[model samples]
Target: MKKLYSLFIALAGILCFTSCGDDYAYTAPEALDVTKADLYFKAPGGTGSIEVKTDRELQATSSVDWCSVSVSGGVVTAKVVKNESIESRAGTITLNDGVLTSLVAVYQEGFAFGIDASNLKTLNANAADSTSVIVTSSSPYIVNIPSYAASWLSYTADEDGKVTFHFTKNESGAPRGANVTISCDDREKSFTIRQYDINSFVGAWKVSYADGEDLYEEDITITSPSTGALYLNFAPLTPTVTPIFHCTYVNGGLKMANGNAQGRYSSYYLFTLFSSTDGYISWAATYTYSASPYIAEDGTFYMVFANDGSWPNKETNGVALGAFTSATATNAGFVGTLATYTDLVLYK
Candidate 1:
């Protein structure tokens, strides 16, 4: 019995010596290291994360309801909500390891921009009729006006936190258009503006034959009896017969229909004697088709008259006149002169 008890005592002593090898237990230092101290998010909020380089477990929390934080595998991620207001916002993300604490600043941008033109996309051409456009944004924005429109369009900010755009009167006869852009942060919006002056074309215009050996230059008068009816005096083109053309507005220009009874025309021989005064026999005759005429964007006018069968160069006995004297004018040389009358352009 004594030998058994001595062996058991020796084993117990060995176990105690093995468990108490050192006076104090070994413990690692408490530490908390975060990779990032700040985070940023766009207006359309999203997720952002930072790396925690510590050996201890940590808890992450956000100070604001708009920003939420979570920790997984030593990575702290923050989720931000979409900011609808125009004002920017900031929050703090706190990380704790029981003994140490770290902080991360979270910033989010706002998304709000608008342009109020009072539902008007076009403006009148009168210089006295100036207009304004209102702008609304949540953040600072930049206005970009095209180089061609910068001279006529301007903007100003009022003390009441309102942005207003001013437009100068457009004196150009034809319609003018431009696109204005507003930029805030990474987003941009464009608005198109148009100005037109319909009555600007009603005035005396210089006229000349597109194709004729005779040097003919005169002033043609254009009169508008109503909003849609325009009358152009043809006395400059034909001295003998003063045909007046009844035109209507078509696509920002004037157009005359074929065989329009409103337009009265007469041949040089039918109206006046060849040896009467001018000594030149004008072969101006009626036509069948008149091309659509339009005013170009550059304020130039263009008109074209084509022939398709309906030529009135026949004699009293229904015989073709063929060709005449120095005043010889063929079906192609009588009215509108050339196939395309671009040389007879009128300018504003």
Candidate 2:
């Protein structure tokens, strides 16, 4: 019985050894392969295909929303839309056969589309007879005109991406603005046109001033004389007198003139009585600027005032002085009592 048992053990050991040898000699299955691993499409994209050389069932997917992929039998197909941008794009198709994976590179040509409207983003035109603005693009684009603005403006586009806009005379007394849209494929750009009347600055304005130490605000009336200069009653500057300042259009801004330049006020107050407080009379008040002041298109006004020996003056703020304290100090007028008034901005 022992010998029989020994023979049984030997048979079992031989079976184990044979199984181990077979394990060493075995080979894994082949990975997924493709006949064509790369596919290219034109700008007007269409379907592309790659032949799979694997016996296993294959699954395919795309990496980009613009590209899609499918697997049928041993073939992988990719479909893509037209590339409408100036840049070229690429994507990949992933193929998986359970045990191994492969990637099929997909390339598509991009259609050029761009608008060079940076230089012509904003255009200002007078109420003259006619005016035109031109823009260039890489591809032809569609011009979207507002329904209200169609009567005054017209456009023409060429195949080479040259767009021209023609505007007729603006009979409207008020300033008018319009925005035109330029679109190519899914991309869009816009530009604005503003037409101004000759007397656009004739109206009421809200004025604000930053005079270094205090902020003075008031509402003023602006009036223009037929064709030349504009005048506004600025009460905040000259409290007891009829405050009026004049400005002229120059270099797209309203250039201001000093009170003396208008021949209505003196260069120096020269002991003028402006206030009386607690039996004390304040005298010799003057507004002076170191630099020429101007009003910008966006209602921004800038001025630089000279330092009045007592207070520091800035671009937006200026210094003023009370020449005398009372009748006893009349000889000490314009000594050192300086108050500053600076940035005087006006907006409608």
Candidate 3:
């Protein structure tokens, strides 16, 4: 027992001496080490912290007002601000622990207006009703479309908060395409649009031709609607008739089957030259097929409505004509047609 007691006493003394070997306070570390890949800030900015390892108190600060940093204990906290400008920005945060210093990169993404105008797709020439497209944007935006496209495209407003795409009929014989771009917060988004040919009957033309030994000149105009309704107009007609004439365009061609007749065309009053003495028969609705609309690479529209049949008065024939620039279409020179006349030719 005495030997055991002596051994215990010796062990206790040794343990006490080892426990009291050193009495030192916490000391500052030699380096500051941060462990984080990167910091991402949302719009305006946010607050976040990262894990750091160091024994001494640290100090932190930002290079720009967009970001700010502070240190508490072993961690570094940052306060990020959202970018109000359209452009994205970047900055840096520096941390120092007495003996060591470190750099951290802080990035902020650009502001988003959330503007989208990708709904519109295609257009038609003789459509009666206008087309529509919805626009979504939280911030202000600018619209950019080609001049030619803008001439026929617009915004259709029915009620508040009801956004629509409004447009006119494409009277050009050729098809065209355009791109609409929206600019927001210095960002850009583009959408594509297309227009189908509404044929050469979409413009005004000065009609000049020789009837027998006498020559007569007439003015004619054509219009296209958003509801696909195509019509033509003349100065004055006999029998007190309306100046507007309803017409049809189909499959890249024109059809005037009984244009001034009854039933389907009853709502409109046609027949521009209805005087039997005038000897210039108005366009008929029968067998007036084989007509097509075409456009040259120079943006000129032309039409071909020729038939190998004779009319009642047979005065002005060969309905082939080109789009009018100023007053007349000089491109159509000598169609060499006399469908309603004995010998007639169309010259520019």
Could you list the CA RMSD of all candidates, in the order they appear? 18.5, 16.5, 18.6
lDDT of 2 by residue, 1-348 (tens): 011000001112222235645633334444466666546766667888877777778898988999988889888878888887657688777788887776666777677555665445243555444433444443346788776677787777655556767677766554455667777666777666656543765776677766545788778877887466777665543444455555565433454443222111233342222221122223322422232334334423332223222212322133223433333335543454333334556654
Model 3 local distance difference test score: 0.49
Q: Which stretches of candidate 2 lie over 4 Å from their true place?
A: 1-68, 71-114, 117-125, 128-159, 166-168, 178-191, 208-218, 225-228, 235-240, 258-345
Top-TM-score candidate index: 2
lDDT of 1 by residue, 60-156 (tens): 8888999988888788878888897778888777778777776667887778777676844344454634445566665567877677666777767
Worst 10 residues of 2 by lDDT: 1-10
RMSD of 1: 18.5
lDDT of each: 0.53, 0.54, 0.49
Winner on lDDT (1 vs 3): 1
Candidate 2: residue 71 Cα off by (Å): 4.1
Write down the RMSD of candidate 3 (Cα, Å).
Answer: 18.6
Error in Å for residue 140 of model 2: 8.5
